[model samples]
Target: MSDFTTTRRSFAKGIGGTITLAALGSTASAQTAETWTTAETPTGNTLYDVERTANGVYAVGAGGIVLHRTDTGWERVLDGGPTGNGNSLYGADVTDDGERLWFVGASGAIGEMDVVSQSVDDHSAPDDVTNNFNDVAVTGVAGSANAYVAGDSGKVYYSFDDGATGTWDYTTPGSGSAVNAVDFYDARSGHIVDGNKSVFATDDGGTYDKIGLADANANFYAVDSDGADDVWIAGGGGMIHHWDGAQWTPADTGDASLRDIEVAGDDGLAVGGGGVVYGRDSDGWNRQSTPTGQNLKGVVRGGVDVAVGAGGTVIER
Candidate 1:
C-alpha cells in the first residue's frame, strides 16, 4: 500500500483487528536498532507515514488524531479526530519546505495539518469521490501546487499550492488499479503503484504508462525518487524493486512482506511487516535489526532514519 501505504495510502480498507508489530514478514530477527525508542502511540491502530518538521514530528493515525513529538516527548494535538467512520490512515508526507503536511487513508480520508498553528483541514468521503486513499506526495506543478493524494479507484487529489486546500480534479491516468503509493519530483513527472506488483510512471502528469517489475502480485506500499532517474519500490513478499533510468530490477531484502520505503537520495531504507530494516547499496542489501517487535510502517530521512507503526511505535536510526 503507499509503499508502506502498506505505508499504503488510498487503499487502507476499513478492516478491524490488531496488526501485530512483527507478524507478516520473513519471520527472521534483524540487527539491533537499540538506540531507537518507540514514540507514544496516539491510538492503538495502524499508523502509516510520518513527517519531521522544524518544530516537532507530526504523525497521523486511525481515529482522526494528529500526534506531535517535540524534543521533549509525544502528545496529541487534537483528541479523537475528524468526523468519519474510517479507521484506516495510510500515507503521509510534508512539503519540501515543511510548510504543508498531509495525511491520507481509507475512504479517501485526508487531513492537512498546519505545522505552525497545528490547525487541520479535513477531506473525507463525499468530499472524496473514492474513499481509498493510500499514499500521497506534494509537488510543485505548473498548473497545480500544494500537494496530491492518491488512492484506490485510480483517483488522485491535487492541492492548490504547497499544502493549501484546493479543487480536486480527480484523474485516472492509464490504469484503474488501486494506487498504494505516490511521489513526484516535479509537476510533470511522478510514479505510482497499483495493487499488482507493476509500477506506473507519468512524464506529463496527465497520462501514466506501465512498467514491469520482477515480482507479480507483490503489493507495494512505498516509493521514492533518487533524482527523477532512479526509483525504488518496497512491498509484500520481501520484494524490493528498483529502476535505474532504464529498467526495473529486483533487490531482495530477504523478507516478502515489505511495508514501506523512502529515500534521502540514492541512499534509501526499506521496512517490512517484520521488525526489519534493509539498507541497499552497490554491493547488495544489508539488514538493520530493530528494537520493538512492531511492524515498521514508514521510513523517511530527515537528520536520521525514522520508522513508525503499531503499538505506539516510532524508531530512529
Candidate 2:
C-alpha cells in the first residue's frame, strides 16, 4: 500500500454546514482574475461529490443528502437520498446529454436522478455485492449510457443497460487495492487509479492495461480524462500527474491532497484539502483562493465552475 492510503481512507470516512460569501481576493498573482464565492447550503452534512447538468448543479453527501443549485440559489431536492436510507453518497456524474445524474455511495448505494422529473431510481447492491463505491462515470445519453463505478474492493463495476440490476458486471484492474476514481472520455475508453499507486487504462470497458505512475508514493484519488492523450490525476502529497499518451509528468501544488479535478477544453480546475483550488490557464496550473477553509472534495468545470467538500460547502467561480 502507498504511504497516504490510511490518511485518505480516514478522510473519506470522516466525511457539514452552509454559508454564503462575497468574492474573496486572491493572494497569488497568477489567480488575480480568479475568485470563488461560497453558497448557502441547506444541510450541514459533508458533501462528497458535485456535478452540473442542464437542470443545474447538484451536490451529494452524508445522510443521503442531495442539493440542487437553481437560478436563484441552492435548495434541498432530496433529504434522505435516492433510497431514503441515509447512505453517504461519495461520487456522482452526469450523462453526456446532461439529462440524468448517476451517484454512488456507501453500502453499495447507487442511484440515477432524472433531471427533468427530479425523480431518482435506485440501483443499489448490484450482483448482491454491498461494498461501498467511491466514484462513477457514465458515457453516452441519459437512459442509454454505460455506467462505470469505482469500488472500494479494487473492482470496477459496469453496466451497459443504464444500471439495471442484472446487467451489472465487474472487473478487477489492480491487485486488490481499492479503486479510488474512474473517468471515461468515451463510451468504451477511460482510466482508473487505485490505492496501490497504479494507473490502468481500458479501451474495451473491461480489460485494463497498466499505465504509468508506477513509482508514485501517494494514493491517487481522482482522475480527469479527455482522451488517450489527455489525462490528469490528483492525489496525496498535493501531487498532480498528467499523461499525454507518452509519459506521465508530476507536479506538486502544496501539501494538501487533491480529491477532485475537471478539465474543459484548455481551462481546468482542481480542489482539495484546505480549500485549495487550482486553476489551469494558457500558462499552467496555479493555485486559487477560496472563501472556505474546509477541505474541498469535488469540482465541476464548464461554463460555470463549482466545488463541494468537507462541509455542505459549495463554492463557485
Provide the RMSD of all predictions against the true structure, rounded to 1 decimal: 7.9, 9.2
Cα RMSD for predicted model 2: 9.2
Model 2 per-residue lDDT at 273: 92
What is model 1's C-alpha RMSD?
A: 7.9
User: For residue 261, what is the lDDT in candidate 1?
Assistant: 75
TM-score of 2: 0.89
- Tens-digit per-residue lDDT, 179-298, candidate 2: 999887767777888999887888778888877565677989998876556677889987887765556667777688999987655677888999989887666677776888999999
The C-alpha TM-scores of every prediction are: 0.80, 0.89
lDDT of 1 by residue, 27-128 (tens): 344344444556655467656677766455777776656677766766778644444564566777765556556677766576666677877676555343
Candidate 1 lDDT score at position 27: 30
**Model 1 CA lDDT for position 138:** 66
Residue-level error in angstroms, candidate 1, position 250: 1.0
